[model samples]
Target: MIRDLARSVREYKKVSIITPILISMEVVIECIIPFITAALVNEIKAGCGLNTIIKYGVLLILMAFFSLLFGGIAGSTSATAASGFAKNLRKDMFYSIQNYSFENIDKFLTSSLITRMTTDVTNVQNAYMMLIRVAVRAPLMLIFAFVMAFVMGGRMAWILLVVVPILAIGLGIVIYKTFPLFRKVFTKYDALNKSIQENIKGMRVVKSFVREDYEQQKFEAAAEDVCADFTKAERILALNGPLMQFCIYLVMIFVLSFGSYTIITSRGLDFDIGQFSALLTYNFMILSSLMMLSMVFVMITLAGESAKRIVEVLNEKSTLSNPENPVYTVKDGSIDFENVSFKYSEKAEKMALSNINLHIKSGETIGIIGGTGSAKSSLIQLIPRLYDATEGVVKVGGVDVRNYDIETLRNQVAVVLQKNILFSGTIKENLRWGNKDATDEELIEACKLACADEFISQFPKGYDTYIEQGGANLSGGQKQRLCIARALLKKPKILILDDSTSAVDTKTDAKIRKAFREYIPDTTKIIIAQRTASVEDADRIIVMDKGTINGIGTHKQLLAENAIYQEIYYSQNKAGDQDEN
Candidate 1:
């Protein structure tokens, strides 16, 4: 965990190293202050001249000023280091997530990743700052002050021997009891974040279903779980303050009562007023350091859980990685799956797709139709290597997908998946993701092919229109057309539309298919749709059923022979055949 986290500290390492050095200098100056005061007291006791006392007082002020100077520098440096560390941490996690296959992404919730990047990283940053500054200062201050106290008061310091041990043991027990509770508290935080994300993203559905009250109740339950766990943990942490104060006062009472008796009985010989005053200063310093140290302990306890969560993300190796020696160019759009069997998880009992053998030649247009569980999307996903085949080779352009550079392979195979996503940007910017250097005319051309140009031109901004996140500003059919335009802009060798045009009317869908046939004829097209009209003109159509191909033939052949295909065809045409006069 330590090594994993340290990787994010890359460029901030110099600042991190400098912070502790400044803190050490600060501690040295701070430890000198009480000694200077002791010297001033002795000067006054000896009836020294005013000049002598002022000189020691000046020295004391200088020590304090230097201590403050170092502290300020350390504060600024540690802040730079911690914030940089957090920035790098987020960058690292995000970069790692970019490489995750669909299967690896299934390992974590979107809410959990959000919590790790924001809340968990922030916690570690604060703790890191505390670790370099306060943790360094507290222990050093405590050790230095204790040595001075023992030097000044001798055997009377033994009182601390008993008192410090008792205080430390009690504090240790409190920390141990609360540590596990803090770990559980962060998991509840994940649940709370999950609720918030789900509610916000599905707000439209909640309001439409008139389940706003139910969502609010669910959110409250999750929030309350977080609150309850935090309350329990904080209540235990609260004991640190009173317990520390109790130990401080008990030690002070003992030190004073014991010091006064020794001074009076020794007849101004053993423990003088000057030494006694310095011992009192050192005593406060020691107890205060302990108090600050306890606070550091509390912060560490909280951050430990957050650190572990962060490390978990940073340590996750992307399940999909490019081969060391990889093919950089695709020869053609041809795709072949040989005896492919795949399951989302290694522990799964059944495969999502099994024994899939198919060959799609370049420039061929293939259509796929299936029921909900027939693995239509799963079969197409293998073409782009979105998920690798578990048992057999999946080849694109006559080369195994595993042998191609992942980015090179994916770039050639564009898939507008079942879920269409448009980022918050101008429509042109969203389309530019397909080809960053695409001219305005190229973008318009792609949209024209996707049947999106007419609707976009109707908007005030045309191609430059700002799209809200998820393209929430547009209607469902509009969003699908825009997404299709984005994919079309890629001009990929293989384009897989997994029910991407489901929102459009059949006529518009037919036009989009017509454009694909005319504009990018050499591109292998695999269209997955529920409607038979969407696939009727394809070179061939494949019927998928229960993770296997049930039939492969023209639409007319399937309508004549295949029972499942005939049933689906009749089911749709039966409705169309109805007339109202």
Candidate 2:
């Protein structure tokens, strides 16, 4: 996992390397300052000359300056390296998501992905900064300070060896207990993010239903989980400060008492006032380094889960990928499903579409009708290979879908799914998604064919009007027509409309179908609709039931022969039905 995270430090490798080197330099210079201070103190005790005083003072100034210089450089380089690593990490995760198939997306929640990319990345960034700076500085600082104390104070410095083990053991216990709590805390972040996203997206419905109190309670529930875990973790981490202080004061008391007794009894021969002062300075240094180490361990514990989450995303390989040598061109619009079966997951109780064998000729107009959960949409999703078949083969243009370059195959097959999604952009911008370089005239022509031109022209800005995110500014029917127009701009060999025209009026739906027939006669059209009138004019109709094809025949033939089709037809064609033609 550490190696996976280190890969994100691509362009920042030099800065990452330089930060620790500078930190090491800073620590060395700073540790020597106290030793030099003890030297000058001893010289003064012996009534040294003014020239010696000036010389030692100048050395102190130069050492302080050099220490500051190295520390500043280390701080800047560490920040640069950490921020660059975060940027690369986010970019890689987003690009990986872009390649994820529907199945892969199903395995992860949208809210979870958002949290991993944002909150998790931030935690890991902070940890990385400390890893390069304090993590390096503290250990080296502790070692150097201990060696200096032994040289100056002698014999008494060994007391630290005993205090050091006790302090380490206490810190280890605290970190071990707090780590699991922090790990659980980040998991709850997913729940908190999900609550926020769902509330904002469904605010309209939530208000219409007057469920504000219910939503508030739900948000509080998620928030409380996050709060509870963090508080628990914090309480455990609180032990570190008291533990460190106790060890510091205990060691200082022993050192001061023992040194004073030895100096007085030995008549200032064993330990001098200068040696005692130097020991005190080194004690502060060692203890300060230990305190910094506690901070490093706390941060590393918090980031352990976050680091794992980040690496999980970076290591996930997309399930769908083009073959080694892929077919680049689609021959025609013909589609064939050869004994195919598909389930959303291996643990699914039943297949979404099972043993589906169907053949569609080029340029044929096929209508599909089914009750909810009968897999009407599931059937056509296979043509674009949105979800691969679990068994057998699905062929498009006389070649298996896996044999073709994914982009090349999908370009020839345009799907206007049930959900009409429009990004925040102008009408022209939305239309150009199908063909990036499409001209204004081409956009208008596609809009006209989809029967969207009239309403678009009625707006003040015409094609230049901006759409809000998720088409919030547009009506349901308007959004659907605009999506259809966008798909038409592709001029695809095969077009599938999966219950896309349901929001439009009957006359508008008929007009759109008429435009399709008159303008793109040779393009194979598959229409999935609930209205019988929508499929009455098609060459054939398919009725699906319980993940299988109940029947397939022309509308007239199905009305006479297929029991499922007869029930659906007469039910919609009652005396007061608006679909009557």
Candidate 3:
């Protein structure tokens, strides 16, 4: 736990050091103010006049003022540090997650990752701030109070000597029992997050089926589990305060009796009862400090566990990182998969793609048609090194993809995923993501090529029209066209449309493909689609089934020679067969 905390501190080195130092100074003043109060009491008891008493009391007031001022400064600085640390930590986690291989991300659920990034990071941040203020302050006060107690009264200091052990033992028991409980709480938190996220994302399906009640019950069950786990942990921790108070009260009783006897027996001595009273005050201060420290320890233990989980993400090495010596240039956009094989997991024998050998030359339009789960997307994903093959090699432009710098490799490949995503921005702004330096002419040309300019021009603001999150403001076909425009704007050497036009009508799809032929004649294109017409016009068509390429040929050749391709082609275009012919 300590090692993990040290690692977090190292992540934000300057702020971590400054926050703790400020907190330490603030706590030192807090500890000294009570000693000054004890001194004031002693002065008043030593036959001091009202003027002298007022002078000491005034000093105590000033000390307290400084203490409050320093404490406030420390708290504000600590908060700033914690907020900044959390922001940076979250950014690092996001970047690390992005770098993870597709295989690695599949190990954890999307909702679980979201929970870790948001709620789990917040937990660590809150605990970090608490540590800066309360965690550091409590221990310093405990030490200062203990030293002051011994200085004020030697034998009476035994009061703290006894209370300390009792407090430690009780705290140890509570922590030992609750440590496992906290781990369970985090797990329950992940499940609760998953349930809520799934419900929201799938709300349309639930409402369509009229299963709102069932979904609500599912969510309620997850929530109940989380609540029960938290309550159990709290119930155990709740015993600490009462146990501490009871033990401290017993020590107080012993102190009162001993001090009274000493005062009664010390006849005519300078050992005043008020001084003994002051000593008792310091003893209580020590006990109170110990109690606060114990609570801090409990929080640290819980945060320590959370911090470990967070660091696991921050420290993870991406299996798909760029090579040390990478190919930075490509003479032609040719892709080759030589005896390539891949599996989502090592334990799973069923490869997502296996023994795949193919070569796609520059400026060729290749279509990929496959049954579901035939690794259609996975095959193209290798071109940009999204995942490395478990066996054999994948080469791009006559150079191994792994040997190419990730940035250079990816720069040449633009992929439109089946699920279209658009950022919250104007239509023009989203399109510019593909080519930041694209001129207005280039933007219009790409939009036209994507067959999106007509609908975009009809909007109130034309190209400047605002798009809601995920392009919710547009229809499915509009979103698909905008996504295609974004990919086209990049002017990549290799453009891949993974069922990108699935939402559009056959006529619009044909128009977009026609534009591609005239506008991007020099670009290599890979089209993955379930509809045979979408790929029927390609220069080459590859049919895939169960991780293997069943056939490779042009549309006419596939119709004559490939049974799977012929079946899919005939089924999709039975009504339009005469026109297609």
Best by lDDT: 2
Off by over 4 Å in 1: 265-268, 575-581
- For all candidates in order, the CA lDDT equals 0.89, 0.91, 0.83
Judge candidate 2 at residue 507 and give its lDDT: 96
**Tens digits of per-residue lDDT for model 1 on 1-581?**
88888899999999999999999999888777777777788779889998897888888888888889999999999999999999999999999888788888899998899999999999899999999889998999899989988988787777778878877887788888888888888878888899889888988998899998998899999989888878887888788788878877887898788788877788547677778887888877887888788879988878888998888887888778888899999999999999999988898899998898899999999999988899999999888888888899999999999999998998999999889999999999999999999999999999999999999999998989999988889999999998898888888999999999999999999999999999899999999999989999999999999999999999989977998998888778866335311
Task: Candidate 2: list runs displaced more than 4 Å.
Answer: 264-268, 576-581
Per-residue error (Å), model 1, residue 466: 0.6
Question: Number of clashing pairs, model 1?
Answer: 0
After superposition, the stretches of candidate 3 with alpha carbons farther than 4 Å from their true spots are 1-15, 18-36, 264-271, 575-581
Q: Give the candidates in order of TM-score, highest first.
A: 1, 2, 3
Please identify which of the two predictions, 2 or 3, would achieve the higher lDDT against the true structure: 2
Clashing pairs in 2: none
Q: Can you rank all candidates by lDDT, best first?
A: 2, 1, 3
**Model 2 accuracy (lDDT, Cα):** 0.91
TM-score of each: 0.97, 0.97, 0.93
TM-score of predicted model 3?
A: 0.93
User: Given candidate 1, what's the lDDT at residue 48?
Assistant: 98
Best by TM-score: 1
